[model samples]
Target: MTEATVGEFTTRASSINRALDQIGDKWCLLIIQEVLWGINSFNEMMAAMGVSRGVLSNRLKWLQEVGCLRREEGVAGSHRPRYHLTSKSIALYDCAMMAITWERDWYQTPALDRVELVHLPCAKPFVAQLRCACCDALVCLRDVSYQPGPGATRDVREKKVRRRSSIAITEVRSEHALYRNLINVVGDRWTSNLIALSFHGLTRFEQFHQELPVATNILSDRLKLLVEEGVLEQVVYQQRPLRYEYHLTEKGQGLFPWFLTLLQWGDTWCDPQGRGKPMQVTHNPCGEQLQAQVHCSECHGVLKAHEVRFTLDGEDMNP
Candidate 1:
């Protein structure tokens, strides 16, 4: 089905097959991951993805048509076109990275070394992180709070969603958000922002409310879902009357990179503040100011989003 048709599936009256379309197929998401990882050229993607030439071509064409990847003529040579992430698809780096990190964890990989984003200002290895524009503080996935924004929806069952704990951020480990570990969880507006705030360490229930005036019902649902998924677990905070606080399990904390990747994309294009330029990320350890820069895994050097190229490694790569 067409993407426009597929979109209706996620909303009310959407069918199960339509839902799959919304998430896209293995080819689409994999192509997305390769671009974010700095594989920009047609050959480079074919090499890395290792899909059949027919499959690769189809997937690439589909992605290009769907507004995810843009085809650009290479400057150096007269050859096949190169693909770059459009602003729209670049915004999905969160989902892409989340997919990659999840795959790395569960799938067998010969190498486990991480490609870190070093803060240019301090020469420190700074991974992407969320910081409050107001307080200028580091936000961990576990510490932030959530309230709905303009795009909030009541798709899930309506009710006053409540937190299982008093505090929203915790050190405990849980396994909820990573169960399927796709980008669908924080796909909505407030969900990502809420989770981002917690990463910045704003976890108290009141703080979540103070920072965000989301409907009580929506917050309750998101919180419950997070709890069920093990992203957050209720902790007994008070003894006499019995109280609890929401803390990020280790499983949740590892998602920091994935969330930061998304925030960076959003801050880049979605933000009204000069395209969110002049964005600053600080080093959690040194407290020194920082910014994230990406690189290619094979090269171990900084990579331009559109500069890196791929080859099929002697295999067909068309989808």
Candidate 2:
């Protein structure tokens, strides 16, 4: 295997990294979002996303390879094949909904407000809430901690140098899709890790550097990207040299649940030994251990994969 691909295979055994590697790119998440919205055919997805046909084709192939989606041949004489979400991708609905909730609260815009999700069983407009699966209490940053899991690997020296790809988001139009915008903000590992650290009260550049061990240039690039995306704002803390600290904006803070959900998933699945969770979470309000769980807005019942249905423009789509 190529050196870079080898590095990815070894490091991405961690569930969170695997998840990000699969769906965290600028186009992958957008493609999944579009598929969920019922844009299935290649032509439809290409038109809706305004993405180059080559990029779209590549992402679709990757998603299918990863078992998140599948393609079915078109009827008898048709040339187009329809893309459908597999159970794996369907399970990501909670994550996407949590993202939308965050956007609704902190990144409000006219275009965003036009899209809405209604729980078919509830028949009322509502937002997703993250509750502790064990005790049914809300979860927060203070409630969690982490350690190495079964899949954890000690740091290794690279056998070869890898080139960095240029950031693609800069070329995307400002008026592009909201999910695409969100992807630009936190699509990369360093940026997402920095945002998660911000929730743990890390702000200064030095603090992020110490916790992450990322290269100076890479860390700087991610911080600048976050600032430009408005997820983080820089405040001057030292005047003489104009040194600054990175602080999470409302938009960044609102992403807590999304990251928290990812953490919970990693802690559960990545640790095979049952030795212990990589992270332990406690619901402060209830003073009990926690796991992030999605619930129905109206009934307050657990939102299981099979129990829910979807609607697009008031038309029911089978889940």
Candidate 3:
């Protein structure tokens, strides 16, 4: 019950939501990866990215301000600032590694980007479940359980965690093997662009293509793949000639937290990449500009990831 040291993670648990918010972005994780891999100087990071100087600077500043990095003086060089990872940032390496693994397996197309990943001790890829923990079935987050882990320390006075009886979880499964599955079914495409058009209500076929001037075949393939995975369902709103629109199912929309996770990560660790500007959402009745905060089902208290517990007995439990 002592306080966690620099190398250890807390077992009591706190803000799982905030932890998710931090490393969940495509850029933040990648930037952090580069920084951890000895790209400590500004010029080094810029060279690694090949992006705009402004973009690189902004991401570095955001990560530093959020306490992931510290700007200390150079040891004996020309007196320039260097970035070093905080203890918290170092702990996040595992999560970032996982996300990168998913990207390589699921989203990758070229041999250059399709690098393999593995965990440290096991030195193996995907030795864990790809499905949601809440509902043991093969599904994404929408109807899934997302309680905190053991090492949490949430703001109990401001938000209380509640118990969950039989939490809702979505089930999913795909027969694909030896690949990084699509961990980000909703937002983010560092190598590509998505969601910005969708958020602007661009559901039509032409609008999506026009907004993102990528190859038509690529977009078509992505769309078809998403539909097949049940992330985006093509619903026919009009019946006369059968007009269809892509709408997010529960599994897709369940990623709103992941969406907020990415947005906040971008805000803190990446530049406002034209698309990465502010997106303020509000509760309709309360008018409160809402950030993504999880609440308990029973008491409606704001939840930390670990305070609640789930039982295995349910209608959709996986064997």
Candidate 4:
């Protein structure tokens, strides 16, 4: 899609989509991960991510423009400047933690298994759990409902004829990369909205289009991308005219926690005036209002931003 088209769609008040548009590309998240790991220099990022220098440069520039990252001068007369995560980007720790949790649970591979996260306070390898902030109950997909918010707009424009990019972002892959793969699957706003809608029981093309206010062309492209990524499986519901329904595969369902984290974050930070959080979640099993919270699986204590540290294959990263 053209830049104008992307801007048109993202103009809507959906905080999740807006957030995705800013930092949802394969290279963006990987860059953030590198910075979080203390690999901040441009040369260091290029060497570690194996991306073209041009791509790295573009991604970094976009990230800085969005205020997710900032550049600082090097020490003394050093040539290599450093990029640091702003508070805005640092707050994404929950999202990244949830992604890693989902990757470990549903997409475990030899490469993923080699990396581990340790909760320093707990002194043990830990998993992240999404619990209700309201009642400390587990939050699931079936517990939430949404409506239009104050920022909601009915500005869906007529479809514009456009050519697809010659190189689709979804077709790009990184070597044994977790965050890149996750972003590749749900990189764009439309694709992320489609996945969120699928969790709401909207499966068919018309259903997704109705709820998302996205162009049919954009919706179709996202659906095809999801199916290609094995997150959504397209099944024929009717043999005549080849009617099909998209269903979440096991891998897709595993993304529930990540989405929940995003929703909670949006509600807390993005909405502010209670306008954007049009959804209310309830813990179905416990019959209480839900606000997802991330906690350490080992100690069952709340996972605060300052309490966690990283380790790579049993070595402390001190990150």
> How accurate locally is residue 209 in candidate 2, as Cα lDDT from 0 to 100?
85
lDDT of 3 by residue, 1-319 (tens): 0111223222222232234334433345556656655577777666664444765676678687778888888788667788888865764533433343344434543421423332233323232222222322322333322333223232222121112112111111111111213333421231123443443356777777765444577677767767886667898878998888887665455434444444334434433233332334333333343334333323434333223221122221111
1-319: candidate 4 lDDT, tens digit per residue: 2333433332345566556656766678778888887889998787777777877898899999988899998888897889999988888888988888877776645555776777778888798888887777665676665556555653333233334434454344433355556766665656787898788788898888767666677788788889988889988999978899999998888788898777666655555445555555567766665667798888888887677766557776655
Deviating ranges (above 4 Å) for candidate 4? 1-12, 149-178, 210-221, 268-278, 285-289
Which residue segments of model 2 deviate by more than 4 Å?
1-14, 109-111, 147-152, 155-178, 210-215, 235-242, 265-277, 304-319
For each candidate, what TM-score against the reference?
Answer: 0.47, 0.77, 0.43, 0.83
- Top TM-score prediction, candidate number: 4
Between candidates 3 and 4, the one scoring higher on lDDT is 4
Candidate 3 backbone clash number: 18
Against the true structure, candidate 1 reaches a TM-score of 0.47
Model 3: lDDT to the true structure: 0.44
Off by over 4 Å in 3: 1-29, 109-233, 240-319
What 10-residue stretch in candidate 4 is worst by lDDT? 154-163
The segments of candidate 1 whose C-alpha lies over 4 angstroms from its true place after superposition are: 1-95, 106-180, 273-279, 284-287, 296-299, 303-319
Global lDDT of each model?
A: 0.48, 0.68, 0.44, 0.72
lDDT at position 271, candidate 3: 36
lDDT for each residue of candidate 1 in 128-204, tens digit (9 for 90 to 100): 33344444444444344333333333233122222332212112121111222344444333454456556657665
Candidate 2 to truth, TM = 0.77
1-319 per-residue lDDT for model 2 (tens digits): 1114333112323445545656766677778877876788999888776777877888899899878789999978998899999877877867876776676666655545655556656666566777787777665555665545544553232222224335365354433254555676776667876887787688999988876666788889889989987889999999999999999887677778887776655554434455444344556666556667887667777666445654444555543
Ranking by TM-score: 4, 2, 1, 3
